[model samples]
Target: TYTTLDIQNLLAGGAGNPIGHLATPAASRAPGEDEILGRVTLKYEPTDRLTMTLKASYDRNSVNNSSWNYVAFRCGLGSGISQLSGYACDNDKFVTHQNNMPADIAANFPYAKKDGQLYNRYESYAINGNVNYELDNITISSVTNFNRNNNRWTCACDFQSSNNATWATENSTWRSFSQEVRALTSFDAPINLMVGALYQKTRRNFGQWVAFAGLRNSAASPENQFVATSKTSFTKGETTALFGQVTWKIVPTVELAGGVRYTHETKDSFFTQPYNNPGVTGIFRDQNDPDGLGVVNANQTFNNWSPEVTLTWKPSRELLVYGAFKTAYKSGGFSNGGINSKFSTNPLADLTFDPERARGFEAGIKSTLADNQLRLNLTAFTYKYLDLQVDFFNSPIFAFQTLTADAKTRGIEAEFEYAPRAVAGLNVHGSLNYTKATYTKFPLAPCYAGQTPAQGCAAISAIDSRQNLNGAPLSVAPRWTGNFGVAYDTDLSSTLKLGTNVDVRYSGSYLASGFNNPLSRQSKYATLDAGVRVGAWDDNWVIALIGKNLTNRLYVSGVVDGPSTGSGTGTAAGIPADQLGFANLPRTVQIQLTKRF
Candidate 1:
């Protein structure tokens, strides 16, 4: 299947620039994708005491996107606005309407004609085998798995009448093999125990290149074009772990459980970009010398222990309470991408980050009311993170960077279901969650675009600065989110059953950037969904009609802050720094059919 998208924007007057303009000429943007998936599973019971299972699957997905971004706004185009003061100007008044805009406008306007295209292909396959053996007093299991993935992405950034456009490509391949063996003792005693050992080895090969089209006299001629490329490669990683867990019945109505895992991992990476193109010297600096250009050969090792403990109490058959404390760890890896040679110069300045560790505590209750007609579960949890891994845009170049910071999160989640015995074939369910996530300590966060030092940023330069986001809430973390739904099913005839369901979901407002700038915030919004299904022959065949986002509410789903550049078709200075991200999809309706054997 292929899909095409037509994006339109309205240029409304703002406080700073109060010259309203009609819609500009529309640009062409389209993205295409294809996906395929397959899986196979086999099981055999050669004997009464042993069983074996094997499974394999494959998935492939590809996408191709091409879009033209029109830079229609420029500074100092409005009346009484001094061009030297750097204010956006409304040039639409000088040109014809969007329907009959002249081609020569591209020559008179200061807009940049940008044509960007991206192609990505990803394929992965995995195979697994498992064996289970039962003994008189215990059960033993062994499993082995292997997986491989290959991905390639290429992007073309073409600008009109400019030699600065670039073509970037990245190719990655991964292979992993893992083995696990476990034993469980089911003794007729008050306590039960299980232990496991696991080992895994993974290898990765990655390559990237960025090519530039140097100064060219004409877009059709490539005689003067030269390409400047940068690349990085990562090679190997291995991990090993041992885990054990035990459960004890301390009393008739209470139980205690504990588990622990010890893990150790090591990784190696290499990077090199041996290119020297004079055309792009002003944009990217080459680090190659007599030794090499930006060559990084490094290795890192990490080890950690994670533990978990839980307690449960059941006073009666209808109610239960539980509490748990757990710890988790994630291994760290190297960072890649960017045109900077800092890694080659400093070697360790920002090459890698520390592992992330988290400690979490949770308590919950489960209850059944009105003689099992209603069920409710509620849980509250708090987690403290040490060296949490975070990804953010590095300034000046807008390259993505990974760092570590201390953070904390607390949240409450609740779910309930009611099925009244008197109301036949009717049920209702709802869930709600509240989260308060914050950065406990982060001193090196970059200030968002247009943010001043007084607004929580530590001044360093006019365009570069850091901020202490110690108490700032985490990006994309909404304080309130909830979903409510009701369902009904009834037998319409001897051979058919009809069912219907409706649900509503909502999310509160949240910041989109680490700087917590109000300009980068998304407002609260809600969506509704409904579905109807008809089944026949004891559900052997079924059909469903579903509708999503019935109201078609338009809202921003994400945001990013970056440099704003203009195409040569507008006045000058293009559009001001504004939030950039995709918006939620409009309302959709679909019908689906299923048959079971």
Candidate 2:
């Protein structure tokens, strides 16, 4: 595959921005990513109206400094720091009347520094054939496609310390195969119709492993070692879809088009784990002993019917308008581990969850101007979601739940592009985009206060009450987001040509909701990127220089809050507040060369 574009990405660790105001200090790790890929294609044309093709593709990706990190300190009774007589006065609960031990340990434990490593490999092979034939007053065509893909990923979290070393590791793989066949027929005159039916099946496999140990001299003992392993398989899922479209020319320059597709999907999955043995201990089982646990099994199935309708209008050659209503479905599945330790006792029966569904409506306009050198497009959309499933970090009090109630989203997006034809050996192009997203409803409240293992079963009565949470904006997703870029190309001389591209993006502040409740919000920031290219040998070979996040702006992209839908707010007052702050990507640069023969 050829390099289509010089793209730059910015990263910010969970902190987003370095600590500038907090009395506590802040630190971050470096970030970088490099990728190389290749593909091949084969085609056969046995007849003028028939063609068959096959394609194979492969990719490898490696990234550094991908782990999560943070900074913080604590001061409390368990800190083991002996305070002056006043220190004992400051906290008396944990100490004698004269010893000021705070009611709770004042822990200021700093956030951990994350150094992440990830390896990914992907492969896909596909074959397709199409045939077109004319019969009397109509033209008919048949098309078929078969495709298979396999993906593997391994990632690790590095502690980067001499002691207190801990690591979270994961290994996962997915394989999918599918086939579809359809036919289209249209009349020769102004009236035309196309109808088709398609069937597809796919399967996926998933696995994970995690291990960690401290750096102490004797930390490797059986009690100190920690590890977990799991495996899941989805044997087969089927989808059947039917579609039809009709177009009336009305006149030579004016035409109207309408189409609809109805799709039914059914899926089945099986999960098993063989590592639980008798030797496991602590809050979780120990996978190191094969006899500690027995194999666990789970089965799940779901079916959904999705519908879509679209209309296209073209009054002239330079403009087009379209509107569509569509419904999309994502298969439901089960989680291998349950929220409570008690659920682990019956692993085979407790891991499965349900499916989620969404419906959307959108309308947009596209137009070209400036002698076809400039293009602009805009779309507005609104969607309703039922049984939305969200994943969150489990907390000590209320357990995490992946299911969410009714939700709604409404937003609009616009993109504009301008490219000037080469003039006097110089060419230039620029583009810009903007979008806004919001949530119509989010259910949240405080669960059992001062109760151990909080009972999160609580309902709301007032739609506008602080707990009702209607009209609250969705966390993590920025309300305003956009990017702009401009590029210029020219020949410096006969043997050398130069090109430069620059792009910038800005994201609005958003609340972190990884913990399930909204906490503090991160500040907004912008980033700039630039690159230059030089070429020789009739432009067959070229060297490029790139710089990313030139501004070095610090920003956080996401945050974690306490539990939602449950009363166990993690805050000091049993209130939910944001926690984890997903840092943004850092600035980086690279030099690359490419050659063609």
Candidate 3:
């Protein structure tokens, strides 16, 4: 549900619960986002054999995501005043609301804070130049690029209704430069070749403020008290790569192609929050201030090779078949949720992770039939992914972390486009895919609420919690997903035309949290969308009206575990609620007007 609800006593035979998330129940007002971008390009051809192109761009975006809030019921010792309804409440979720004694800090309390969920601003600039020279049957090209980005964001780390966590913010800057040079041969020979080399360097600086109030189940941060921990970090990286590709046309209807790339990369980062003081009184210092306490700096190098090979056959002008095998790699990096106390207990959480790698193969066929009226394609693929990067939201820490896992997956995809001869202005297109993805090794996946010791659940707070998920499916919906769309266009007059389209999408059930969280499961659903367009037969102006999600399916798109919620104990342990759900947008309509230049 988009809004949170207090379902303590209202489930079976109780009276009812309260609503959450939305601040103005009777009104709707949203902020306006602004974005600006400018670009310029220049091209020159001084000689018949040489050409040069240069482009530069600047972009800025300001966003305000401060319109969301939520209220939830947690387990407290006895009963306390309900913050949302101002009512007295024992155990809340499935029992009576209770509060704690004067001495007990863990009291069942109401959590219903509102507004300023998030805000962000970003600005970037880029400049790129390309040079190409042609000689005989070979063409040599070089590309150089320089880019910079500055970004900032703030969040009310506390998702509850209380002002418990008015503390999370970040500022970051990144600068990068890269250059690549390659030569390609386009000779009318049986063999073709392409070779390239690339070098890149990037530098980044970041700073963040952790939750000053800290995450609590039934409590808010001390008023006028500032316990925010300040942390700053930096990263520097350099990479060099060499790649080449060869294509051999063995026969008129058969061909073979292969390519390989070797990369050497080095990374250096200050991954520790040395300035963070894990005491009752936290120091408010920035990253620039020299206060070295903790220790988790990363200075590592990695080498990898990526290769791909393909063979193709064409039996006729309209039919083609191909198969290929490929390998890929992604470098690992540090995380930046600031100094987390859980890291002290689970040192691995603060350490750098291994690189992620994948090897896969695919076979596909493409065909056109019925006098160019039909086009169809099909592909089957399988892959083994090692050290896959997975993102998790640690509700207690109000931070995001990246974990690693090993997975295996196989899938098939099919698509088709058709234009019936009987209907000159009608077209139909659709695609379908089915995948089976499973975690071959994931011993420390986050457990859902209420998971017990028998379930291999363990925790040092929600941020460092884990459970066994080795045999679970990697994707929530590992079955079938597909979409079908149809469009029709007809000329109404010599200068006007009418166009209409309808699309439908279907998906199997999946977990909103991506992990195997039972409480965050989303049921199988389908949606319908349709649109109408009218224009002066292309050359001028056009108007379009579109309706999206006409079925108005109510489903959760993602979730964040509530405070101490994923500790696997749940409210039964007098903690926070299981999870907070973010719902997908409902049915909506839009009207657009366009003019061609």
TM-score against native, each model: 0.80, 0.69, 0.79
Give the range of the ten consecutive residues with the poorest summed lDDT in model 1.
1-10
Tens-place lDDT digits, model 3, residues 17-59 = 1112222121122223678898899999999999999999999
Off by over 4 Å in 3: 1-32, 47-49, 66-118, 211-227, 271-295, 338-351, 392-401, 454-466, 536-540, 564-577
Tens digit of per-residue lDDT, candidate 1, span 1-597: 000000001112221111212222222332345789989999999999999999999999876522222121222222423122233322222111111112222222111122223456789999999999999989999999999999876544321112123445577889999999999999888899999999999988776655433221132213112224456567688899999999998998999999999999998877655553443333333556443535667698999999999999999999999999999998888765533443223544355668999999999999999999999999999999999887765544424466788999999999999999899889999999999999999887766554554555565654346778898898888999999999999998999999999999999988866557565566788999999999994899999999998987655545543222211111122222334333454577889898876
Which ranges in model 1 have alpha carbons more than 4 Å from their true place? 1-32, 66-117, 156-167, 211-226, 281-287, 290-293, 338-344, 396-399, 460-464, 555-557, 565-576
Predictions ranked by TM-score, top down? Answer: 1, 3, 2
Model 3 — TM-score against the truth?
0.79
lDDT for model 2: 0.47
Over 295-322, each residue of candidate 2 has an lDDT whose tens digit, in order, gives: 4344445656666666777878889888
Q: TM-score of the candidate numbered 1?
A: 0.80
RMSD of each: 9.4, 12.4, 9.0
**Candidate maximizing TM-score:** 1
